[model samples]
Target: MKELAGKVKLVIKFFPYRYRDYSRIAAEAAIESWRQGKFAEMHELLIKRSPKLDRDSLISYAKELNLDVEKFTKAIDNQEGAAIIDRDLKLAKELDLYVTPAFYINGIKVLGVRDSDYFKNIIFKELENAKKK
Candidate 1:
Protein backbone atom coordinates (compact mmCIF):
# COMPACT_ATOMS: atom_id res chain seq x y z
CA MET A 1 0.00 0.00 0.00
CA LYS A 2 2.89 2.33 0.69
CA GLU A 3 3.94 1.89 -2.93
CA LEU A 4 0.58 3.25 -4.03
CA ALA A 5 0.30 5.75 -1.18
CA GLY A 6 0.03 8.82 -3.35
CA LYS A 7 -2.02 7.14 -6.05
CA VAL A 8 -4.67 5.47 -3.95
CA LYS A 9 -6.56 5.66 -0.69
CA LEU A 10 -7.30 2.76 1.64
CA VAL A 11 -10.46 2.60 3.64
CA ILE A 12 -10.85 0.01 6.42
CA LYS A 13 -14.27 -1.34 7.19
CA PHE A 14 -14.82 -3.74 10.07
CA PHE A 15 -16.83 -6.93 9.51
CA PRO A 16 -16.45 -9.02 12.64
CA TYR A 17 -17.73 -12.55 12.22
CA ARG A 18 -20.65 -13.10 14.50
CA TYR A 19 -19.49 -16.61 15.35
CA ARG A 20 -16.24 -15.52 16.93
CA ASP A 21 -16.74 -14.93 20.61
CA TYR A 22 -14.37 -11.99 20.71
CA SER A 23 -14.71 -10.61 17.21
CA ARG A 24 -17.30 -7.98 18.06
CA ILE A 25 -15.41 -6.92 21.18
CA ALA A 26 -12.19 -6.61 19.22
CA ALA A 27 -13.96 -4.49 16.65
CA GLU A 28 -15.22 -2.24 19.41
CA ALA A 29 -11.73 -1.90 20.78
CA ALA A 30 -10.53 -0.88 17.34
CA ILE A 31 -13.22 1.77 17.15
CA GLU A 32 -12.23 3.09 20.56
CA SER A 33 -8.63 3.25 19.42
CA TRP A 34 -9.71 5.10 16.30
CA ARG A 35 -11.53 7.60 18.46
CA GLN A 36 -8.27 8.13 20.33
CA GLY A 37 -6.34 8.69 17.09
CA LYS A 38 -4.44 5.41 17.47
CA PHE A 39 -6.34 3.24 15.07
CA ALA A 40 -3.25 2.08 13.21
CA GLU A 41 -1.48 1.03 16.35
CA MET A 42 -4.45 -0.78 17.78
CA HIS A 43 -5.15 -2.37 14.45
CA GLU A 44 -1.66 -3.80 14.17
CA LEU A 45 -1.71 -5.02 17.73
CA LEU A 46 -5.09 -6.66 17.31
CA ILE A 47 -4.01 -8.47 14.19
CA LYS A 48 -0.82 -9.63 15.82
CA ARG A 49 -2.67 -10.83 18.89
CA SER A 50 -5.87 -12.02 17.31
CA PRO A 51 -5.96 -15.22 19.32
CA LYS A 52 -6.13 -13.26 22.56
CA LEU A 53 -8.65 -10.51 21.97
CA ASP A 54 -10.47 -10.84 25.26
CA ARG A 55 -11.61 -7.72 27.10
CA ASP A 56 -8.56 -7.62 29.34
CA SER A 57 -6.23 -7.91 26.39
CA LEU A 58 -8.08 -5.16 24.61
CA ILE A 59 -7.54 -2.80 27.53
CA SER A 60 -3.93 -3.90 27.73
CA TYR A 61 -3.43 -2.99 24.12
CA ALA A 62 -4.99 0.41 24.72
CA LYS A 63 -2.63 0.97 27.62
CA GLU A 64 0.29 -0.17 25.51
CA LEU A 65 -0.66 2.43 22.93
CA ASN A 66 -0.78 5.04 25.70
CA LEU A 67 -4.43 5.76 24.97
CA ASP A 68 -6.83 6.96 27.61
CA VAL A 69 -7.58 3.53 28.99
CA GLU A 70 -10.55 4.66 31.02
CA LYS A 71 -12.06 6.40 28.03
CA PHE A 72 -11.47 3.41 25.80
CA THR A 73 -12.90 1.03 28.32
CA LYS A 74 -15.92 3.23 28.86
CA ALA A 75 -16.51 3.60 25.15
CA ILE A 76 -16.31 -0.15 24.59
CA ASP A 77 -18.59 -0.76 27.55
CA ASN A 78 -21.05 1.73 26.17
CA GLN A 79 -20.92 -0.01 22.76
CA GLU A 80 -20.08 3.23 21.02
CA GLY A 81 -18.50 1.35 18.15
CA ALA A 82 -21.63 -0.69 17.47
CA ALA A 83 -23.29 1.87 15.24
CA ILE A 84 -20.34 2.38 12.91
CA ILE A 85 -19.63 -1.36 12.75
CA ASP A 86 -23.29 -2.08 12.06
CA ARG A 87 -23.27 0.37 9.19
CA ASP A 88 -20.16 -1.19 7.73
CA LEU A 89 -21.60 -4.67 8.09
CA LYS A 90 -24.77 -3.55 6.34
CA LEU A 91 -22.75 -2.11 3.50
CA ALA A 92 -20.76 -5.34 3.23
CA LYS A 93 -23.97 -7.37 3.11
CA GLU A 94 -25.38 -5.12 0.40
CA LEU A 95 -22.18 -5.63 -1.55
CA ASP A 96 -22.61 -9.40 -1.13
CA LEU A 97 -19.32 -9.78 0.68
CA TYR A 98 -19.12 -13.08 2.63
CA VAL A 99 -15.41 -13.14 3.27
CA THR A 100 -12.81 -11.27 5.20
CA PRO A 101 -10.07 -9.07 3.72
CA ALA A 102 -12.07 -8.10 0.66
CA PHE A 103 -10.97 -5.29 -1.64
CA TYR A 104 -12.62 -3.10 -4.22
CA ILE A 105 -10.47 -1.23 -6.65
CA ASN A 106 -12.33 1.13 -9.02
CA GLY A 107 -15.53 -0.66 -8.08
CA ILE A 108 -13.95 -4.00 -8.95
CA LYS A 109 -14.50 -6.31 -6.03
CA VAL A 110 -11.66 -8.71 -5.27
CA LEU A 111 -12.30 -11.26 -2.58
CA GLY A 112 -10.12 -13.58 -0.40
CA VAL A 113 -6.44 -13.50 0.39
CA ARG A 114 -4.25 -11.98 -2.29
CA ASP A 115 -0.54 -11.53 -2.59
CA SER A 116 1.15 -8.15 -2.78
CA ASP A 117 2.01 -8.72 -6.42
CA TYR A 118 -1.64 -9.30 -7.22
CA PHE A 119 -2.56 -6.01 -5.58
CA LYS A 120 0.29 -4.23 -7.34
CA ASN A 121 -0.90 -5.51 -10.70
CA ILE A 122 -4.44 -4.31 -10.05
CA ILE A 123 -3.21 -0.99 -8.72
CA PHE A 124 -0.95 -0.39 -11.69
CA LYS A 125 -3.75 -1.31 -14.05
CA GLU A 126 -6.03 1.13 -12.31
CA LEU A 127 -3.42 3.83 -12.47
CA GLU A 128 -2.96 3.28 -16.17
CA ASN A 129 -6.70 3.29 -16.72
CA ALA A 130 -6.95 6.57 -14.86
CA LYS A 131 -4.23 8.08 -17.07
CA LYS A 132 -6.02 7.00 -20.24
CA LYS A 133 -9.11 8.82 -19.00
Candidate 2:
Protein backbone atom coordinates (compact mmCIF):
# COMPACT_ATOMS: atom_id res chain seq x y z
CA MET A 1 0.00 0.00 0.00
CA LYS A 2 2.87 2.36 0.72
CA GLU A 3 4.09 1.86 -2.82
CA LEU A 4 0.75 2.97 -4.15
CA ALA A 5 0.01 5.51 -1.47
CA GLY A 6 -0.62 8.47 -3.71
CA LYS A 7 -2.47 6.48 -6.35
CA VAL A 8 -4.66 4.44 -4.04
CA LYS A 9 -6.77 4.85 -0.95
CA LEU A 10 -7.45 2.30 1.73
CA VAL A 11 -10.69 2.26 3.65
CA ILE A 12 -11.15 -0.23 6.46
CA LYS A 13 -14.51 -1.54 7.59
CA PHE A 14 -14.99 -3.84 10.56
CA PHE A 15 -16.65 -7.24 10.35
CA PRO A 16 -16.20 -9.08 13.59
CA TYR A 17 -16.98 -12.77 13.58
CA ARG A 18 -20.28 -13.46 15.32
CA TYR A 19 -19.11 -16.82 16.66
CA ARG A 20 -15.75 -15.68 17.95
CA ASP A 21 -15.56 -14.92 21.65
CA TYR A 22 -13.36 -11.84 21.41
CA SER A 23 -13.77 -10.64 17.85
CA ARG A 24 -16.31 -7.98 18.69
CA ILE A 25 -14.32 -6.63 21.58
CA ALA A 26 -11.19 -6.59 19.47
CA ALA A 27 -13.00 -4.63 16.83
CA GLU A 28 -14.24 -2.23 19.47
CA ALA A 29 -10.74 -1.75 20.80
CA ALA A 30 -9.55 -1.06 17.27
CA ILE A 31 -12.25 1.52 16.77
CA GLU A 32 -11.49 3.16 20.08
CA SER A 33 -7.84 3.24 19.15
CA TRP A 34 -8.77 4.85 15.88
CA ARG A 35 -10.54 7.56 17.83
CA GLN A 36 -7.25 8.16 19.61
CA GLY A 37 -5.28 8.09 16.33
CA LYS A 38 -3.67 4.79 17.27
CA PHE A 39 -5.63 2.51 15.01
CA ALA A 40 -2.60 1.01 13.28
CA GLU A 41 -0.81 0.21 16.52
CA MET A 42 -3.82 -1.38 18.15
CA HIS A 43 -4.58 -3.33 15.02
CA GLU A 44 -1.04 -4.68 14.83
CA LEU A 45 -1.12 -5.70 18.47
CA LEU A 46 -4.51 -7.33 18.14
CA ILE A 47 -3.33 -9.39 15.18
CA LYS A 48 0.03 -10.27 16.69
CA ARG A 49 -1.58 -11.29 19.99
CA SER A 50 -4.74 -12.97 18.92
CA PRO A 51 -7.23 -14.76 21.21
CA LYS A 52 -6.15 -12.54 24.10
CA LEU A 53 -8.49 -9.69 23.47
CA ASP A 54 -10.17 -9.71 26.85
CA ARG A 55 -10.72 -6.42 28.70
CA ASP A 56 -7.40 -6.56 30.48
CA SER A 57 -5.51 -7.31 27.32
CA LEU A 58 -7.21 -4.45 25.52
CA ILE A 59 -6.35 -2.04 28.35
CA SER A 60 -2.78 -3.23 28.25
CA TYR A 61 -2.60 -2.61 24.55
CA ALA A 62 -4.06 0.85 25.01
CA LYS A 63 -1.51 1.65 27.68
CA GLU A 64 1.31 0.24 25.61
CA LEU A 65 0.24 2.44 22.73
CA ASN A 66 0.14 5.45 25.06
CA LEU A 67 -3.52 6.02 24.37
CA ASP A 68 -5.88 7.53 26.91
CA VAL A 69 -6.76 4.40 28.82
CA GLU A 70 -9.70 6.00 30.56
CA LYS A 71 -11.30 7.09 27.32
CA PHE A 72 -10.60 3.76 25.64
CA THR A 73 -12.01 1.76 28.53
CA LYS A 74 -15.08 3.97 28.75
CA ALA A 75 -15.73 3.61 25.06
CA ILE A 76 -15.29 -0.14 25.18
CA ASP A 77 -17.55 -0.44 28.20
CA ASN A 78 -20.21 1.64 26.46
CA GLN A 79 -19.89 -0.38 23.22
CA GLU A 80 -19.28 2.89 21.45
CA GLY A 81 -18.27 1.21 18.21
CA ALA A 82 -21.23 -1.13 18.07
CA ALA A 83 -23.21 0.98 15.67
CA ILE A 84 -20.30 1.28 13.29
CA ILE A 85 -19.62 -2.42 13.51
CA ASP A 86 -23.26 -3.22 12.93
CA ARG A 87 -23.35 -1.03 9.86
CA ASP A 88 -20.27 -2.63 8.44
CA LEU A 89 -21.63 -6.08 9.20
CA LYS A 90 -24.76 -5.25 7.26
CA LEU A 91 -22.68 -4.20 4.29
CA ALA A 92 -20.56 -7.33 4.51
CA LYS A 93 -23.67 -9.46 4.56
CA GLU A 94 -24.97 -7.59 1.58
CA LEU A 95 -21.75 -8.41 -0.20
CA ASP A 96 -22.08 -12.04 0.88
CA LEU A 97 -18.82 -11.90 2.74
CA TYR A 98 -18.36 -14.68 5.27
CA VAL A 99 -14.63 -14.49 5.75
CA THR A 100 -12.05 -12.24 7.28
CA PRO A 101 -9.33 -10.61 5.17
CA ALA A 102 -11.67 -10.04 2.29
CA PHE A 103 -10.89 -7.03 0.16
CA TYR A 104 -12.60 -5.26 -2.70
CA ILE A 105 -10.25 -3.64 -5.13
CA ASN A 106 -12.14 -1.31 -7.39
CA GLY A 107 -15.29 -3.32 -6.65
CA ILE A 108 -13.46 -6.59 -7.37
CA LYS A 109 -13.74 -9.03 -4.50
CA VAL A 110 -10.49 -10.72 -3.48
CA LEU A 111 -10.38 -13.15 -0.60
CA GLY A 112 -7.68 -14.42 1.72
CA VAL A 113 -3.97 -13.72 1.54
CA ARG A 114 -2.00 -13.22 -1.61
CA ASP A 115 1.35 -11.89 -2.71
CA SER A 116 1.75 -8.18 -3.30
CA ASP A 117 1.85 -8.67 -7.03
CA TYR A 118 -1.61 -10.23 -6.87
CA PHE A 119 -2.98 -6.97 -5.48
CA LYS A 120 -0.75 -4.73 -7.56
CA ASN A 121 -1.91 -6.44 -10.73
CA ILE A 122 -5.55 -5.87 -9.80
CA ILE A 123 -4.84 -2.30 -8.80
CA PHE A 124 -2.99 -1.61 -12.01
CA LYS A 125 -5.82 -3.11 -13.99
CA GLU A 126 -8.28 -0.94 -12.14
CA LEU A 127 -6.18 2.12 -12.77
CA GLU A 128 -6.16 1.40 -16.46
CA ASN A 129 -9.91 0.84 -16.45
CA ALA A 130 -10.40 4.15 -14.74
CA LYS A 131 -8.28 5.90 -17.31
CA LYS A 132 -10.36 4.37 -20.11
CA LYS A 133 -13.42 6.04 -18.63
What global local distance difference test value does model 1 have? 0.92
The numbered model that scores best in TM-score is: 1
TM-score of model 1 vs. true structure: 0.92
lDDT of 1 by residue, 47-122 (tens): 9998899999999999999999999999988989999999999999999888998998888889999998998998
Q: What TM-score would you give candidate 2 relative to the actual structure?
A: 0.87
Q: Model 2, residue 2: what's the lDDT?
A: 69
Please provide, for model 2 over 1-133, each residue's C-alpha lDDT reduced to its tens digit, 9 standing for 90 to 100. Answer: 6667679977889999988888898999999999999888888899999988999999999999999999999999899999999999999999899887999887888998899999999999888888899
Task: Looking at model 2, report the run of 10 residues with the lowest lDDT sum.
Answer: 1-10
Candidate 2 lDDT score at position 116: 92
For each of the candidates, give the backbone clash count. 0, 0
lDDT of 1 at 29: 96
